[model samples]
Target: MASSPSHLSSGSDLEKREKPLSELTLDKPAESPYLNDALEKRVWRKLDLYVLPVVSVFYLLSFIDRTNVANARVAGMQADLKMTNHDYSVALTVTYVPYIIAELPSNLLLKAVGPNWMLPTMLTLWGIVATLQGVVTSYSGLLACRFFLGLFEGGVFPGLVLYLSFFYPRQRLQWRISAFFSCASLSGAFSGLLAFGIINLDGVGGKRGWAWIFFLEGIFTVLFGVVSFWLLPKSPAHAYFFNENEKNYVIERLKDDGATGKDASVDAFSWREVRKAFMLPQTWILGVVLFCDGTVLYGLAYFAPSIIQGLGFTAARAQLMSVPPFAVAFVTATISAFISDHYHCRGLVLIFSSVMCVIGFGMFLGSQSHSVQYGSLFMSIPGTYIVAPTLSTWLANNAAPHTRRATAIAIGFILTNSGGILATWLLGALSPAPRYTKATIVLLVFSVLMVLFSALNLGYLWDQNKKKRVIREGMDRSKEDPSLGDKSAWFEYNL
Candidate 1:
């Protein structure tokens, strides 16, 4: 039988290129059976059991802490602190400064510290800061706490994406990312319910309802952080639940999928990798795309409750109303991620979701009826949430070498947070809410641009894939250098 070329090389070092691919084979141990479909399924189930839930918990808290100020607004936070409109917007903007600045550095830190340690540490620090927001007497105090909160929380989402890429193949990554990101939507849903209950604590212990919201949520976050220290595994090699055979199987599966040494932590930071990540046009394309979506996402997350309040519901009723769109979003985003992964078509899925958002925003801009606006929210929320994981995984899957992928993910997230900053100022101050027609129009413009970017991204990936295909078919020997990683001739982009 003609031998299939070996794509499974180990380590991040340049030495992996020393051997020719035609001379290499699937190098499983003699004692181990080749991984069959059933065992692969079992492995995935086990991984999901350990990895997904803990990461989701961490992110859920992150989303809540970052956006809960929105909930607090209706609970009398702005009035109690005597914050002017400008003051509040500045507080929101400051958080993103540290948040964006810390993202890339945090990814590098995660590589050195290991995710199990680094993640819980960030969560704990942010939790303390988030909890302390309850005690703030002035707007400046709120800004300080939020800045620290952003500092701690910045790298987590991107860092987790890099960590997960180590375990799953590119074809399988979107659903996992979506499943993890669904927690953000779930956090949105839960924040509303939690705020509804917490706001009823008005005047208890002489503290306002909004203060209690921060204090309680922070305490829960701290407790969860403590638990994550034990539950979250660093890598396949470090997982306690997996025996030696299972560990080897997990590691081998990734290598077989064209990932080299992804199961190992990228301990040393590389400037070259950083440069490579920046050099890719797709990285900037996706970053700009994320920025556009980020405006919509953060704008909605930080203000959705307020937007609902504008629709004639009481603050409490508005909180309750905010829950459904996010709940629906969680469901739709999970389904979209699953379909994107199953079809290996992240770009198309991203485009579809972007277009949906544009349509929803168009309705929001034109319609006068509250009912139409509310329905438009259902359209907009799911589109915004679904686009996040799909686009993130798309960029991640196309990047090669673990460190380079980490850098790209980090840069992309920085853009995401930058958009969040712009969104805050635009929606909060510039638009003059109670009816943010101007902001809705701005967001609609962003969505229209996102659809164009997504299509362009898809076309670029298709063109690159075709070019690679031509090179691959023309080659007599499949002896490409493995060290080239994603740049290697055999690496195909998922379109």
Candidate 2:
């Protein structure tokens, strides 16, 4: 063999070279500053103390404003507006129309305007519209207000997801996302209790209980919006509590964990990237899986009380009955997120939870007994909720570059909401009462499909991991042996 370079021939120089290798290969590698538990705990506490509460409250308001209409309907909103059953469905569909259309652009604006300003502004605008809903005297007026509510509230969820990405790494993000999303479940249960209280206020100042629903909830939303602007942190780099050293440590540690810094430039959206996203086997696979999820999700939200009311409860009692499923969902979602993070495996959790949903839906479809059917509904709700945040966090983790991740998340939401649209028609008034057999069947079909798609996605990712390993090995070997020459190697994540 040829003699080593003169620098490496010296014993001291060789030791210096070997020291780094020894350190890297050691059983306990040197821990990064950001990885320090004390430091991470401090940051986590800051986020928990300051950020989570604000975001949770904001999303609570958003969820209340968006879905409380269902409660309003139960409290005689349909009668007040002379809205036929079909018209009520139309109003629900109208909100989603603008919601689906505005999602992508709104998230892009969230990136530009910063969550501190954008989220609160969006909330304020929707609050104004939601309050206006209380004043509507005609079916057309309710439609107008619903459309604008969708327009404003459209930005809330996805914007929050993108915003969370700025503050935490992918693994830690799951719990927060689940916690935030649990607000919807919280709102579902709380809305029932609140509607119970507000309905008792029906004759107060000549406003109906339904009007009080919009008025009080809208006011709370507006106030929370104002508070959010003041309380929310701008970004990790700009987090007011952390020192300069801490900020740099956070940014660098995230980089080591495969997350690019907030300041790093993401590739602009291009047809090429769009094609890549669309063609990636995971994209369509997740799309279908999420589509199924959306169907069950919105179906339960829109029709749960209706189903319960048909089971012999009065309207108010039916609303109360809707509470348990959502409560179960909230608790299960939080637990699932923590478990998924603990294991660092999302796909298995998703598959298992989705199967729970299938079983729940199957029970609902097959059973005629009220208690058994309702119990199934409860199981289905939590299982579906469990899959959602995990699926979202999984998608966010797999996407590279900030812009691409944003695009992928937005696309996933688009697909999911499209399923929501399908839900509107599937669970229409034409469906039989007490049973809603058509709706139940549709839910069962989609839940099974969701399981299948999730399985397919996991398989694809496993194969992609294998291919990536092979390519990386080849590249390393090529570096060591020049005879292999220079060849570029690249691979895509399954989805």
- Where model 1 places Cα greater than 4 Å from the true spot, the runs are 1-35, 261-268, 474-478
Clash count, one per candidate: 0, 1
Best by lDDT: 1
Q: lDDT per prediction?
A: 0.83, 0.75
Q: If candidate 1 were superposed on the true structure by all CA atoms, what would the RMSD be? A: 5.9
| Model 2 C-alpha lDDT per residue in residues 1-495, reported as the tens digit of each score | 123345444656535333322232112111222133334567777877778877887788888898888889888999988988788878888989999888888876666677888888998899989988888889999999999998888868878887887777767788898888888778888888888778988989988899999999998888877777788777777888776655655565555444442235433434454445555456678888888898888777777777788888999898888898888888888888888887776888888888998899888888788888889977898888888788888777666555666767778888887887777767766566778888888888888888888888888887776676687663542243211111112323422
1-495, model 1: which lDDT tens digit per residue? 112223332342234333332233345421222334434576788888889878778888999999999999988899989987777789999999999999998886776788889999989989999999999988889989989999988988998898888777777788999998998999899999999999999999988999999999999998888888999888888888876656666776676665544334432467887888889889988887999999999999998998999989998999899999999999999999988988777888898999989988988888899999989989999999999988889888888777788888998999988999989988788888667988998899999889998899889888987887788776742455545667766677778
List TM-score per model, in order.
Answer: 0.92, 0.88
Top TM-score: which candidate number?
1
For residue 457, give model 1's deviation from the true position in Å. 0.8
Poorest 10 consecutive residues of model 1 by lDDT?
A: 1-10
Candidate 2 regions off by >4 Å?
1-34, 261-263, 267-275, 474-495
